[model samples]
Target: MLDLALEIAAELIRRPSVTPEDGGCQDYIEALLQPYGFRRIRIDRGGVTNSIFLRQGERAGCLAFAGHTDVVPTGPLIDWPHDPFAAVVENGMLHGRGAQDMKGGIACWLAASIRLLRDGVPIPTMQLLITSDEEGESIDGTIHIVKHLQSHGMLPDAALVGEPSSHRIVGDTVRRGRRGVMQVRIRFDGKQGHSAYPQDADNAIHRAIPALHRIIDLDWGNPAAGFPATTCQITNLNGGTGASNVIPGHCDAFLDIRYNPANSADEIESMLRNACNAEHVQLEFDRVADAFATPDGPFLDSVTRAIRDTMGIEPRLDTGGGTSDGRFLAKAGIPVAEIGLTNATIHQIGECVALEELAALSAIYASLIRNFEVNG
Candidate 1:
């Protein structure tokens, strides 16, 4: 199992599929699964590659594994210990850009599925939802696939997102939920004038300061259970012209808010508008991702059991993380759990994962598939 996973991970890393570009990664995946009785369904859009590989089972329900083939850009060739796309393995670590975030995870899932079939294990209907737009705009990624499944009444009972969710070990942690992201751009308008003529022009900076203070102090209520409190930060602020002698006519501020389910986008937007009460101020809010939590139930219990059975460790059910494609599945009323290799070096220059960790994760995924029951 480990050897097969390593081979697939190496092949995937060799492709420089950055952001929205698949770089032939999906084609490679399709080729691998087609021989295993999996049928490929293409749902590409906006130049983004999305495919669903479905393998019918002798069992009753369908199970889906969601993942991405694309990776973030490599920062600099000189900075990396090995080529980011080289998939080098040394000292038990697989080194590359997507090793942990997460070509490695996808490899583990495929390896487990292949092993199960070869061993004559009774498995449920399986679906591999692969997308290349995860690291970019995400406008035409898994969401579209979920829509297609929904229209055809083919939604799985649950889904396991192959993100690097573990922290210290392969099965030490799993994310049952994620906080939502909201971004705002606020622009304050004022007449420009010479600094010496204070009475002739209103200072945009002066107008922005008190409102920003109000925004900073606005009350966001207590957080939801099993999640962190809502957080709002003024990420960027620009007010003055380069010339100190000029009172700027415009001031711009950007806010990044990560909110728990306790606060809705509507409530947050209303509060910001009321706080920046100046008529000349303009506020634009983009609810980038919606907060979602899968309540504790059979699906979660099965995942925890699989981790404990495979690695002898009771995993932490966490909700802390940046937004992910899991939000889309959760929004569609499907229970989602994120599990995979350790995320110690995800999105870093020296990003890599231990070969043993990949093997352990593959075992865990195999356990999940073997023991999964839709009505459990």
Candidate 2:
């Protein structure tokens, strides 16, 4: 299994599967799964690459594992200690792009599946959903995959997303859920006039200032679990087109909201609408991901027990992060949790993973699978 882990990670790194590009990363995974008895399903919708492979069991519900193969671009390759694609193992760490953020995770799953198959274990059905569009818009990855699952009745009872959730140790933390994300583009409209004649026309920037303060002042983090309330921040702004003398006709700002579970999407949308007022400002929102809370039920209990039994410590339940593919699966009401390697180096040049954690995570996954069968 360790050999498989190392090999797969290197092979995956060789492919430059950046956001929204498969880069043959999914194809490499399918090749490994095919030899092991898992049925690979390539799900492409509207030019998106999301592939799923399943190994059916004689029993009932499915145990699903979700992850992405896409890696963020390796910026200024010279910063890396070794070739990001070479996948050098230096000082007990396998260094490469996507080593920690993902590929490491996918490798662990592959290793676990191999061990499970070799053990002749007979239990619930298992599924693996992999996509390469996570670092981008994420619209074509897990979102479309979940929709495909629903239409064909492939929704799993529970899912484990292989996101780099642990802050320090491998199981030190687990993400129970993620805050919903909304990227808003607002355009404040006003009549262009001379800067000297202040009363001739409205200044869009001046009108936008108050609304910006209102948005900045809203609480985004939740009180419970240290989760902040609906977090709103202005990411970018543009008004005048170079000439200082001109009063711009339009002022634009990009706002990002990471809202908590306490508010619905409609509620947040209404907040934006009301704040914009009728000042001719156009408020447009494009949802990146929805907020999902993990249930404290049998599924979670089983995973928690498995982690404690293996690591001798209970993992912390966290809700901090931009988003994960789990966002889509959680929409089905399945309890979702993230478990993976340390995330300190993800998306960075010379990204790496501790080799020991790779082996440990694989064993941990296998143990969890066994525990799920026994507890179920």
Candidate 3:
């Protein structure tokens, strides 16, 4: 299983599939799963890339493993010891793009799925969901795959996202939920006029300042919403010309928001508009991901038990981090838990994964699959 995991991981990192690009990584994944008996479901709706592969066991429910095949672009190649897509392994550390950030998790998970298939003992249906977009402009990916599933009347009983979650020793931590993410791009308008004739035109900068401060300072996170104290951050603000004397005609600010599940995207937008009482302000929203919380259900317990059995540690369920594909599944109303290698080096230049952890994760996943749908 470890060999298979490494093979898959190395094969993937070699593909160089940066965000919004498949780079044939999806093809490789589908081919690898085909020999293992999983049926692939392709979904290409309006330029989005997503696929779901399913393997059924005769058990009473369904279990899913989800991951993104995309990796964030390697910022600058100079800092890396070798090519980011090289997938070089040395001294027990595998280094490459997506090595720690997550291609490793996907590989380990696929290995487990194959192992479960080899066992040939009937269990619940198992699905593998892999997407080609996650690191940028996530316009499609998980949500699209899920929408396709919903349209086809196929939803899972539970899911496990192979996102990098462990912080220290493998299995020491597992993220059970994630905070929601919301962003707004607002444009404020005012009549253009000369600097000396400021009275002739309303300064959009002046008109927008008070409202921007209010919205930026507004607490978006609410306890009842199951999140930390929500706060809004203005990422970009522009209003003035090169000439300091000119009072710009238009002001624009980009806002990013992360809240909890209790508030809908529409509610957050309304809240922002109401708080930002600027006249002629235009708002555009992006990927308003809702928060997710996986209850202590059968699937959660199975993962915990699997971790303890494999790694000799009791895992913790946490809910506080940036968004992931897990939110997509949670929105689909499936109970989910996360388990994987330490994330200390994720998205870093070296981005490596511990070999032993990979083995342990595969073991844990296999154990969980065997025990899946079992009553507590």
Candidate 4:
């Protein structure tokens, strides 16, 4: 099983799939699963590639594993010890761009599923949801797959997202929820004039300072349990006109807010509206990702039990990540848990993962699949 996972992971890492490109990763996955009776359903849209590999089971209930084939852009090639797309394995580590972030997780899941099938183990129907639009704008990725499942009445009883959620060891931590994301673009307008005469120039920067201060001071209240307080950051601000002597006519600011379930997007927008209430100020809000949580139940119990049984350690049920494709699955009313390889090196220049992690994660996934039961 470990060798199978390593081979698959190495092949996927060598594909050079950056951002919205699949790099033929999905095609390889289809070929691998086709022989195992898993049928692929394509949900391509807006240039994004999405696929659902479904296999009917002899047992009751359905299980789904959601993952992405896309990886973030590799940084400076000279900075990396090995080529980012080479999938180097040395000193017990698998080094590559997606080794920890995602492709590794997907490979482990596939290994576990295939191994179980080869052993003739009776398992629930399985669905592997793969997309190539995760690391980029996720407008037409898993969300589209979920919509298709809903329309076809094939929603799974539960889903496990392969998002590299572990901290120290594989199976040591599983993400039960993630904070929401809201990006704001604020434009402040004023009359541009000479800076020499304050009376002749309306300083838009001056008008923006106080309003931005209010936004920073806005109370987001307390966060929900197992979650952190909401955070708002002014990521970008520009107001100067090239000439040091001239006052800017307009100021542009960008805000990135990460909020827990304690605050809804609507409420946050309202608060921002009140803060920047001037007629000249315009605010555009985009609810990029909505906060979601999977309450403790049979589904979570099964996940924890699988980890404990396989890894011989108590798993920490955490809710402290920026955001993930799991939110889309969770929003569809399915119990969702993110369980995967350790994420210590995700998105780093020399991103890598221990080969042992692949084996352990594959074992945990196999255990989970063997003992999974739908939560009422």
**Per-candidate local distance difference test:** 0.92, 0.82, 0.81, 0.92
Stretches of model 2 off by over 4 angstroms after superposition: 20-23, 45-48, 183-226, 233-256, 275-282, 373-376
Model 1 spans with C-alpha error above 4 angstroms: 78-80, 187-214, 235-253, 276-280
Residue by residue across 84-105, what tens digits does model 4's lDDT show?
9999999999999999889999
lDDT of 4 at 128: 97
Question: Candidate 4: where is the Cα deviation over 4 Å?
Answer: 76-80, 185-218, 233-255, 274-281
Against the true structure, what is each candidate's TM-score? 0.86, 0.82, 0.80, 0.84
Supply the global lDDT for candidate 1. 0.92
Question: Which numbered prediction scores highest in TM-score against the true structure?
Answer: 1
> Per-prediction RMSD in angstroms?
3.2, 3.8, 4.0, 3.6
How far is 192's C-alpha from truth in model 1 (Å)?
8.0
lDDT tens digits, residue span 1-376, model 1: 9999999999999999998988898899889888889999999999999999999987877889999999999898899999999999999999999999889999999999999998898899999999999988888999999999999999999999999999898889999999989999999999999999989998988999999999999889888767889988999999888998999999999999999878888999999999999789999999888999888899999999999999999999999878899999998898999998888898899899999998999999999999888854
Cα displacement (angstroms), candidate 2, residue 264, comes to: 1.5
Cα displacement (Å) at residue 307, model 2: 1.5
**Model 2: lDDT to the true structure:** 0.82
